[model samples]
Target: MDSGATSESCFAKARKSDKTRRSWTEREEECLIQALKEATTQGWKSGNGFRPGYLAFLENHLKVSFPDSNLRGNPHINSKVHVWKKLYGSIVTILSKSGVGWNDTEKTIEASNEIWESLIKVDNTARSMRHKRWMYYHDWCEIFGNDRAVGDKAEHFAAAVQVVLTMTPELPNNVGMSLDELFSVDEGGAESTSVSLTPSS
Candidate 1:
């Protein structure tokens, strides 16, 4: 047999394959939005954190796909929440090193900018996972009826935000002074789009 194959053979093999290619639907997005909004409100920033659950819910259920990685990153393990987990981890690092008071409001922007700068330092294209996580957060908010996620991108991670906000002389009226708290809403009936993030952030 020749080493090369014809287009007909390839087509025949594809047709014979048992599995079907997965694509997204609107209903899946609806369920995902509901689950995420609830999770974000009730347990949005859990002890482990938010992004893990968010991404898992999609890949496991809603079927939000991921882009193929040319750089050898774990494509099968990608999700909105997972991206946030990594970004939040980075944010936490910057916060831990800052040693800024939790109640020192003056350092809020400074700490925030540092975190953002660190992110830019890592990737200037603004297409980094951290930046994408922020886009996910912002888009989620827009769908959930919020003008924005609130606070700087640095505030996206609670562990980091808490360190700086707590140091502030006065916390926000919400009382938590963390990204989790600041972005939280009632989530009573917040049903919107899903995390069908199938490539191209």
Candidate 2:
């Protein structure tokens, strides 16, 4: 007998997924930053911001079992994502550009290379290409390289980017450097600044 229809369970998508964040300990933070430095030394500067390959490289390169932290598992690929951004700055970057995601790190890097190829092909800045299925080098690294896809694969990069943005000292603002270093605690639950040349008498 042909079943009329096999109904799908509503709770299918709601499986108990493992929490995907490792606490941003100092050592991991150091490894992450060092990875960035290595990339830079290899001509992978964040001058125009981040790149997908760079992002993948960072995540993958940080594959070492960093001594100790209250962290759990995701099979530990070539890397983990988002720890450095937490310790340092935000990833989104309003002023800078952005990257896109593919199925895996390979796809992501391949996508970036393809876009770069096209940009160089036309001999334009490819300025118009930002976030339209692809992105410019600067934009790709800053945006797509920073953001994750619509589902669970997104990990910690986005959060880290946010941290970077928060830390970034922009115009018409004084709250740079973690928003903590710039202010006092006794504001009574208000967001104000405390910049004075000297302590008043």
Candidate 3:
């Protein structure tokens, strides 16, 4: 069998495995947002210094939000360094997009180093994962789901946007900015037809 077909088969299996693992619930979203906020407030500079309190907070959240999720003893969430690194990615993405910068010199330096290290890790991870069949399977499953098609690029694009839309509400509100402003609301509080998924020729 061709590599592409083999990869697609694996991807389909992964998608059918569980929708819950692929996407987070609204409660989980709120918890994640709150956790990040609390962690930042507690001076969580990097993965190395991830506090025990934060881990406990997240552990409680997982227990409450996903009682059946077998998150207990899960290295992904239990390991201090691993959880911190993942949450660091979320912080970097949000703060960078919001054009927020650190005021203190120590914090600024730490944030800059974190961003640089994260970028290198991202590049290295992407390169290493591309060669692995499992990575291809997971990536394809995430983008196209079980109903993968030959030319469903538009659907994939729309799905990606929908994922972003879900995260928008979780983003922290800044002093002069808000995610709600991104959408143009009409008289009845409905999004206008101007925002479209179809590619214009």
Candidate 4:
């Protein structure tokens, strides 16, 4: 079966399975974030640039982090998948308000191309092709502030570039510095500015 079918099957099974359900704790959430960071840092990619084995890894961490709880045979991966959807959905909403709609792949590509020009202007010293691409992505998040959920994923990077590309043209000259420090809260809220922008730098 295809991925969509597989996901539906798995979730259906989860819904009927007699698994112990527990509330997510603050420490468990931290462990999830750490696992994600490690996966990204280690260049772990599954289908379509998404992390492979992340759910399994997170299950291991949860077992360790919540050792006091009797989590044996719990459907940890399935529960984590549910949590991931909620977290990822919140991020999608925040990006949408920043003018970076994730549904339009063509628009994302167009924005990425446009943002590349701006990245080059900021970092003309980059020589290697790979290095240039890296710099472009790294600066993309900073230009519009950070999205911790997306982290270092390329597709998310491209969408972020699109958001800034769409916003930059409308910025007033005096607010450049403020724009540099602008960011959206991850709670599905609108973007907010943190600093002032000046022409000098």
Candidate 5:
């Protein structure tokens, strides 16, 4: 191969490796969730999802929180948000079905072996989620709960939100508190509060 071709091949391989190496630590994920909560409080979020440039805001927040992480908005932050939404949607679908339940304490889907067998038969993708533990489910709910599309799906999302609210006792003031108030009062506390999914007028 020519020297120019060899150089291009090496550069492509490096880029691919860098992309594949992107992974989030627990602290980094917490920071990301916090950043997203702050953005929602700032009214950058809408029913359809976060407004344009929110990814840049998230990138900057993560950069400040973990300077060595070198995360970018285009692929890194954007990809993470996409993944959270997809997973959150899947969990919502699972919980919306009959005979399926959410274990708030264990942060996992609760179902019988028969239920799993039936579900997997209909949707093979659900098989992987059988053993998955979603530690950040509530946080993702606060972020994407009200961001659902219109019609039947939106109603399903709302029902899932209600189920979460009923199961969660830590968020006593979920109703009246704005996202800003929720964050401010809990800022010094170890645990983050779940914001009300109702969009601000």
Candidate 6:
């Protein structure tokens, strides 16, 4: 019995399992994002983020969309969502900085090499974002922008809320409006109501 051969076979098996676990096609990501949007529309999402069981909903949705994907709610969908939130946070951080900006035409973050180097020093994850196209930036904003919570998870959400409020146009007869009211969509309407952000007394 060759122990070295046995160990190599075990290592190969582990690598194969990991590859299978990490495989996510572009179509699958699109499907997941669509499902998340649907979940938000259905009111599964709230101020604190998606309610419990949303993962199961997403898993079932993906299963129906791709019967052979074999994705699970526990790790596959959960891990992907976590990664997306982190990526979104990194992008938001990049844009929040004075030297960085978003390139609308290229759908990528725009920053000088010096700026990129500075950001990458603070966050190593930003390295991969250089000149990388992020097609789902707006979708991510829609999905996670309104999340209001305490601590680290809410950091990006708070920044995004500020950005959205700054971009929103003021309306006549606007005096006091809560964040919810500002972002609320009219009944049977596809667009969100535009309201100015006013400081609460």
Clashes of each: 11, 22, 0, 5, 0, 0
lDDT of 3 by residue, 1-201 (tens): 699999999999988665324344556545554554555556643433344565666666667667776543334344533433443433333334323343343332123545545644744542322212221222222222222222222233334555666869775545464434543345364222222243569
In model 2, the Cα lDDT at residue 26 comes to: 56
Residue pairs clashing in model 3 are none
lDDT string for model 6 (1-201, tens) is 699999999999999778546778899999999999999999999665789999999999999988887798878899899888767767776787878888888899998999989988987878988989999999989887776432233333334565666777563325487655555445476322332243458
lDDT per model, in order? 0.41, 0.41, 0.44, 0.45, 0.79, 0.77
In candidate 2, stretches whose alpha carbon ends up further than 4 angstroms from where it belongs are 1-18, 64-201
| Per-residue lDDT of candidate 1, residues 1-201 (tens digit) | 443567778877898662333333445435555556655666444532344555555444433332331211124224433444444444334334443222233223133556566655755632243322232333343233221222222232345445656779485655546465565544465431122112345
Q: Could you tell me every candidate's TM-score relative to the true structure?
A: 0.26, 0.27, 0.26, 0.34, 0.67, 0.67
> Which stretches in model 4 have alpha-carbon errors above 4 Å?
1-20, 47-52, 70-74, 98-201
Better of 2 and 4 by TM-score: 4
Clashing pairs in 6: none
Comparing candidate 1 with candidate 6, which one achieves the higher lDDT? 6
Tell me the lDDT of candidate 2: 0.41
lDDT of 4 by residue, 158-186 (tens): 34544656779874455464432443335
Cα deviation in Å at residue 175, candidate 3? 50
lDDT of 6 at 38: 93
- Candidate 5 clashing pairs? none
What value of lDDT does candidate 1 attain over all alpha carbons?
Answer: 0.41
What lDDT tens digits, residue by residue, belong to model 2 across residues 1-201?
233232233243334233332346656656665676677667665433454466656665666545343333332322343332321122222122234333332222223756556644653434433334322233234322433322223223434344556777473444456434443255465322222222358
RMSD of each: 16.5, 23.2, 23.6, 19.3, 13.7, 11.2
